[model samples]
Target: MNTEQPLKERLKQILNQNGHALSFEEREILLHELIDLHGQAKEGKNNETEQIRQAFLHNLCHVPQSLTHETFSRFFAENIKPADFRALEWEMPEQYFQITEALYLLRSHIETEKVFDYVTELLVHALRSFERNGEYKKMIELLQLVPVPPSAMNQELLSLRAQAHIHETRRVQHFRQLLYKYLFLQALLIFVAFPILFVKAENGAIAKTIEEATDVEMTEERVQYLSYADGLYWSIITAASIGYGDITPVTNIGRIIAAILGSMGVITIGIIAGLILDRITPRNF
Candidate 1:
């Protein structure tokens, strides 16, 4: 049985509901209606295009799926006139325009088995739109959809793919750098807190124990006990939640500060791990 015939009939029912020829605007509207209907019936609503160009793609998707690959190849190859496209370019929304241009490329590729100048132009435009919109993932997917044309166009495709990759890498690095900055700030907080707590602490057993362990002198007066370098080293150990027991605080305020630093260390570690996993994870194209 011909699946396309039934699908075309469904589309015609939608298009002919008003009993009019397909106007440019009505074509767009009816296409959206079809997409919504199709989503309800067949595919899920997980696609970004479902969010961005819900009406056009849904209807366009049906057109391609209705026919066999060969039929689709031939249909576009024979029917899309350059003059018609030139005219459509002036009127169609950019989302529609990009899809149409991609169709044209597919059609041309089917006929000649090589890349055309038009395909190059279409890719460049698509890349710019995707990059501007922060759609690096979409760009990666689109690049894959783009059939490798001739040897000349292969390089262009590779270059665009590389550009998308570079953008993604930079984004991951930025996130990692941000995580590192937070960790540094938290460590600095611990560094500053250690000395202050040491000075404020009474000359109790805990103070004397820390002094002996760290090989430093803790005075009852509000004076520095540990050097700045030692303070920072101790801060790192505390932030790591290691609790080496060599420089523990006996005062209530010191214990409270230690608790806060431990919590912060856990959160910072979690964020850094998540970011690293995101960078390493394979993205679905």
Candidate 2:
């Protein structure tokens, strides 16, 4: 609170006055921590807990803005108000916040961390939702709204935070697009692949292969998106061509679809393997 000393001067003093070896990542991490704490302060209520949270928030907020690039929770930190925390229900976990008490050390944490935890939970939920259904449009909007640290602060550092942020942002964008494709492909399995796989049944019932393979449910409203596990399962089932005896397409059209998935599934796995080989091989990632 020294008026004569500007915020930057104070921070420079804190950072440089005690000459410590700090890497660019470390520097950016510290800045992110500071911003997160400050965001904590801005949302404090009038209660005693709020007072403490605000105090910490203020201390961190007063630090000189980073001259180097670092991304932190710019969205919430910049726009946060004291009363925003009160509307926690909107971000609350499925109307059953109490269930998560066991997961997060709610009782021991500073009130600010509790809020941070809340934000983290919401984030995971949103990401998982997007991952499941390839709900591309909504997912992208939420991605933009994520509370990443700003990349503009801290000009003097081993590595510019901006570059790191860009890398991360690009990575996320790529996955989002890729996941979207996979989701579409999952649904497309029925519409595109099945029509080609159906074989005529002697009982006048079109048997996929003289086998009692389950019919895959091809509902327009119901979209089945695979997860990391599901994708793995898909690979296993598709690679081995051993239907799980569950979740199959039954109609002649469905059979055709399965046939397509079965064949594509083999090459798909190979393509993934090639990519993995390429990455460790060099630039695969």
Candidate 3:
């Protein structure tokens, strides 16, 4: 019996039957009217009125087959005001996503160059959101979606894309450099410590070639000097996984150190290889 019920049903029927017949301007006007009606009906929790508003909004957002670039530009200018695209305090509004989606749909229907400024502005706005949230990866992915802009157009898009890649590459490179330094320092420390450990081993840590060659053990001084030299050489070769067999570890402690050095060598080499590949490989995006 309610008048609002009949009005809501009538609006829904009009949208369902004659929606495509209406021009964008007329549809936009209807959408605004439905929004007001929906607000009033919200107090009464009228689901039917909400459905009608949504239907009208859906129709408004879509581009018609007969739509022309000029009419689209005019309608876009009038209905999609610049003020509506302004950044919100917390999150972007639903309208922002809707407008972007509409713009994407309009790409086939209209010359994007005509709306280049608006498209760029929207992209910048979206990027600012990601930047504020520290979502660099998402920013890169979003930039990838856009085709490379022609040089004749504003260079802002190209600049933004380049800057994002540069920033990401620098960040990755900094981390890799830090990791490389840490590994190098660790290897250096182990190299320095090897002689000390070898000198203290109860049994000679390395093969006693000088003692064995003469069939008379070398003097303590000679043994000590050779121990230091052998320790330095062995550490380098073992850590590099290039055991030349000219120097070798004989004791348990020496073998344990060899294992550790070998593992570290593999890891270090992997990191270096990754760095080289990253430098040489062309990034797809």
Give a tens-digit lDDT track for model 1, residues 1-285: 765456546655764443344455555455555544444443443332233233333334334332234533443354333222221111112443455455654744455433254445456656655766677867766655665545646564667767887876777677767767876776667768654554454235466677899999865633235555655665678768756887765565456667777787778778778877775454433
**Which pairs clash in the backbone of model 3?**
none
**TM-score of each prediction:** 0.45, 0.23, 0.50
**Model 2: which ten-residue window has the lowest total lDDT?**
152-161
Top model by lDDT, which number?
3
Query: Deviation in angstroms for 162 in model 2?
Result: 2.6
Stretches off by above 4 angstroms in model 2 are 1-154, 190-260, 269-285
By TM-score, highest first, what's the ranking? Answer: 3, 1, 2
What's every prediction's RMSD, in angstroms? Answer: 12.8, 20.8, 11.9
True-structure lDDT of candidate 2 = 0.41
- What is the TM-score (0 to 1) of candidate 1? 0.45
